[model samples]
Target: MPKGEKVKAILFDANGMDREIAPLADVAHIPDKQIYWLIVSGQGAGKLPHPADGIDRAALRRGGVVVSDDRFCFSVPVAPNEGGHSEDAMILVVGRNWLVTCSDAPLSLTERYLEHDTGETLKGSLTAPALAVSLLLAHFDEFHTHLSAIEEKLDALDEQVFRSRQRHDPLNTLAVLRRRAARLRGLVAQHRSTIAALDRPDFGPAVCEEDRHHLTHLAGAYHRLVDTIDRTRDAVLSSYDLYATRVAQNTNRLLQRLTVITVGIGLIGALAGIFGMNFELALFKGEAPAFLMVVAGMAAIATVTLFMATRRS
Candidate 1:
């Protein structure tokens, strides 16, 4: 395979045993009785032969789906980046006996599904629609994993917001998380109509009874996934509110301290200003005694002011 192109083919025989085949094997040449899955990574989608007729290449590139009598084609978002941006989508084209998946990069979920049976047991031969649903469900699992990781981060952020004495605002961090949650929610929602369409009786693929059940189950799973994302978003918003409250409390405490200091200084300055006046009064005749009296009086005033300022309201 070329540097930007990689392919993996898995052929499932009549006995339900899956084995690897040549990466470049032609789908048209494969036997109709056997079901095969082709995964193309990087720029492999462009290099490989098109999987089915009536597939809109433009729509596939733009993260859209096309369903027809002979094929079902759609694009789903891949795992998101740390910054919450979904930079690419994986395209899936399903035919009667074959299924082809293409993405900008190799997916670990796909590899794991290929390497080990992740509870999706193959009782009989795997049908193309069943394989497609399985892969779709696997992608939904990725969404849950990603959200769980986000939830952990939110937990850590909660600790930082409430317990840590660090004087940094968590708004930026919270904003990033909010954006990530929104992006995830948007990506999951994009498939809502498409997934619902799969359950419709008029859907193109000749879905088997078992596959239809799986498809219905997949729809339900998608709904749950959306609900999870919504809750995650709510958590982020709640964190934002908590952070704002913390900031307001800190600001109030700082202002109170500053007000106390200002009041104390003003009282002492007023006393000093009066003593420095040019008017020579009888009290100034006793130089040492008068200076001592002024000092004591200022001290007394400062003590009173300090006492009043320190008292909690």
Candidate 2:
């Protein structure tokens, strides 16, 4: 094991024996082909299981899968942290009777899996390949929790858009939601590729029937999640379109009102210009009544223009 690496070894056999043991220098001591799990974390990749030298140390540093004749190694992505960044540190190495896993960081799901009752008994019946799939199934459970959170956020956004009367802008909220959905989609795609590779017949030893069924069902669940996100993205885009339409209508209405007021002012200007011209007219001899009459006429013109504009609206 690597210096300062947190490594744990557990042996489980068909005889119901379950116990932790120190790193055995030889694998031939176990005659029943018993299952062994060597779980490591935080720089544990420095000491890989024997016969796994073909597994590239560099590729194992990231989240991906690589298979050779004797061993296959892969990585699983954990859920994003509070900072909204996913750290890919979980790596798995499968051999004939032993499975080794490493993560650059401590994973919550890993802790939970270790504490679960099924974890102790899984080796009794499951092969190395099936055990790996089971771990992925557990990871999918975590992924679904994240999807549920996104659904709640989408529901709130839908409510705010449709039910609220306040002039609250949802642009920022929509942008955030879209980003979250996109990130999830990318992660799901990566997982899908990894799962597909594992499902291939030539990937490694055949998994048990139960595990194969579970994997198929899990793939279906992932597809459903992707479809749900697609619908959510569409719904958010529709809300944006609705908001823009409402804004355009409001602006056009305001312009219509301003146009009416402008025409009314022009009417008054035209009348004043005609009277101010140097022309001999009997109607306006610089009398107070003539001025009052002009004022009344201007007021009447403004009122008529406003009434006509409102009626049309």
For model 1, how does the per-residue alpha-carbon lDDT over 143-198 read when each residue is reduced to its tens digit? 89889988898888888878856456678778888888998888887887778778
- Which residue runs does candidate 1 get wrong by more than 4 Å? 1-4, 12-17, 23-35, 42-56, 62-65, 68-70, 118-126, 269-286, 303-313
Overlapping backbone residue pairs in candidate 1 total 0
lDDT values for all models? 0.76, 0.69
What's the TM-score of every candidate structure? 0.77, 0.70
- For candidate 1, give the lDDT of residue 50: 49
Off by over 4 Å in 2: 9-38, 49-57, 61-72, 82-84, 94-99, 112-131, 147-151, 154-169, 201-203, 270-313
Highest TM-score against the true fold, candidate: 1
Q: Which pairs in model 1 have colliding backbones? A: none
Candidate with the greatest lDDT versus the true structure: 1
